[model samples]
Target: MLSKVVRTIARPFDERFNLTNRLHESLLDKPVPDHARRYYFCFGGIAFFLFLTQAITGVLLTMYYVPSQDQAYSSVFYISNYVNYGWLLRSIHNWGAQLMVVFVMLHMLRVYITASYKHPREFNWVVGMLLLMTTMAFTLTGYLLPWDQKAYWGSTVTISLVEKVPFFGKSMANIIMGGDKLGQATLTRFFSAHIMVLPAGLVLFMAAHFWMVRKQGISGPL
Candidate 1:
């Protein structure tokens, strides 16, 4: 039985299609710079890991979440109070978001100070910027989903800040608020953007970012 299982696992690896070989060459064959052994050089990887953590925890939270204005707070309260490990999920999602933003910015700073965004790597910088923005949007949208006092006021303050953005300020604020005031529509829109729109943007930009990094290789040791 053991031999058969080994053969089954090994069979696909030995196929003529060269899939395993290609994957090994693309991933396992890559080398790390000696400098990457240091802690700060790990910022980018840490940021990506935090994003994955957020994605997982966010999805789990959504399963028990109620997006309606009337029940949004009650649902969150129930999860935190009643559901098994629900507080753990929310805690991970919340802190993971904060850490993700910090690490992404730290990674950006490391790249900047090291001049990693030069020459063949300039485009990856743009990809990173877009990813950073998407992460922040995820933060904002997720913040408002609970519809609690803090979340409500936080989003209101955010809209007020955007409302100061000159010509398009009021228009954007109105769109975000779902009307002249914050209401059920605001929660619904925020929940949609949180679980749907911004995540798609993150995935798209993250894929491009990783592809570019793999193609260009890591920046040289400084």
Candidate 2:
């Protein structure tokens, strides 16, 4: 019975599996192409590596972070000044985030220029766009967590900009701020969005993105 079931499942897969054989045949039966030596083929892998670094560092930083307006700045300061190598970890998390954003952008540009968005890759392109937006949202929401003058005014500017978006702009700003202005309420909201909502969304999108990549396989060099 088990053998019958195994054969049932394996038969369709065997019938459809041509690409692997074709790839092996091409590689072993013919000469390799020259342009394949370029470094650009590795950009996606590098972007993924940066994202893993960000996740690890972000998790560590969360251990010491306090989300309240009064304590947020002080907790970050303590991490920077008191904890051993905490500053280095936090700095890497911060700058690593910036670099991840840059790399993801470059990866997307590479995909677009190579026309990897065509056909079976269109959904992957959409997922990449969502990931990009989530990265920016993470940065914006995180900016408020430090609660310094820079963080305060930066968030204030962001909220003000949101309030200019059109019909529901003011309401959207209020929803994000959790009230009329930036305060404890706003801080709490941003913290929740940063640590919870955005992360959740990113994870969902990332799963879809990666699954699509595996299914469709890497785009060939143009």
Separate clash counts for every candidate: 0, 0
Please write out the lDDT profile of model 2 over residues 1-222, one tens digit for every residue: 999998788777767986546766754565434654467666767777887787788888889999987799999999999989999998998898788788888888888888889997888888888999998998999888889999999889988999999999999999998899899999888888887898889889988997897676676777
Best by TM-score: 1
lDDT of each: 0.89, 0.84
Candidate 1 on 104-176: residue-level lDDT in tens? 9999999998899999999999888898889889888888988888998988898899999989999998999
Q: Which pairs clash in the backbone of model 1?
A: none
Ten residues in a row with the worst lDDT in model 1? Answer: 11-20
Model 1 residue runs over 4 Å out of place are 1-19
lDDT of 2 at 30: 51
TM-score for all models, in order of appearance: 0.91, 0.81
Badly placed stretches (over 4 Å) of model 2 are: 1-37
What's the C-alpha lDDT at position 39 in model 2?
72
